[model samples]
Target: MVLDTVMTTLHVLVGALWVGSVVFVAGAILPAAVEGALDAAPLEKIADRLVYLSRGSSVVMFLTGGHLAGTRYTIETLTGTGRGHLVLAMLALWLALAALVEVGRSRLVDGLQEKRVRTPAAEVTTVFRVAAVVGILLLVDAGLLASGLALY
Candidate 1:
């Protein structure tokens, strides 16, 4: 029971951070930059800080979420069970993670570092658009799973 409580707490906290940060970055921060309302250098700096924050939160979510699901929930329940919501939530998480790593870290960073973008304005806008969409999806997924409404 104690372990259950601890794990639940960890899972909830991590999930909230993971989801909330993504939402804030995507919905609030990105839009401002994309609209050219924010300066490019400041936006880039914010993006860097957001990346760092996301890394830490994602790591915690991955670790705690794995433990919670693996220890508290059966594999059958997660996959084969009639829990379609859980399945969808899991799939969304996976997709979000993929977007973060492949698109955000690798592709976005590579483009930025290589000076592939015609201007800092263009690059910032591009990154903001992609991150905003992906981040919003990730947040929704985590929020659903964390709420326990995803279970069968």
Candidate 2:
């Protein structure tokens, strides 16, 4: 019971951090940088920092989520239950989020590091917009899963 509670808490907290960072980057930071409200140097720095933070959160989510699934659920429960389906959906979403972040980091951060020139606003915007949409979906899915309504 204690392990259950601890793993659940860790999963939720890390998930929130991951989603929140994506939203902030995509919605606020990227837009501000694009519109010239924020400086490019600082924006790049923020993105660099978030790359590590986001990766760390993803690792935590995977660990805690795996533990919860392994301990609390059986193959029958995972395949037969509504919550099981939700868990599967959430896993898919998590994979998508991971891919999107990796692509964004490679394109946005790598470009910045390799070339001293500022990354094009349009490129940043495009990458971040996709990531933001996925991030929002993750949050909504999490909400539904938590409420036990994800499969309904």
The candidate that wins on lDDT is 2
lDDT of 2 by residue, 1-152 (tens): 99989999989888888888888888877776666676556767887777787789888989999999899678888888887877887888888888787777667765566443244544766777787787788778778877876453
C-alpha lDDT of all candidate models, in order: 0.57, 0.77
The list of candidate 2 runs beyond 4 A from truth reads: 114-119, 150-152
Alpha-carbon deviation at 110 in model 1, angstroms: 6.6
Candidate 1 lDDT score at position 125 = 46
Worst 10 residues of 1 by lDDT: 115-124
Most TM-score-accurate candidate:
2
Candidate 1 lDDT, tens digit per residue, 30-120? 5654465765455556657667766776666667667666676676677665454464476576456545633443444444454433344
The positional error of residue 81 in candidate 1, measured at the CA in angstroms, is 1.0
Flag regions of model 1 displaced more than 4 Å. 84-88, 91-98, 101-151
Instruction: Report lDDT (Cα) of residue 108, candidate 1.
Output: 41
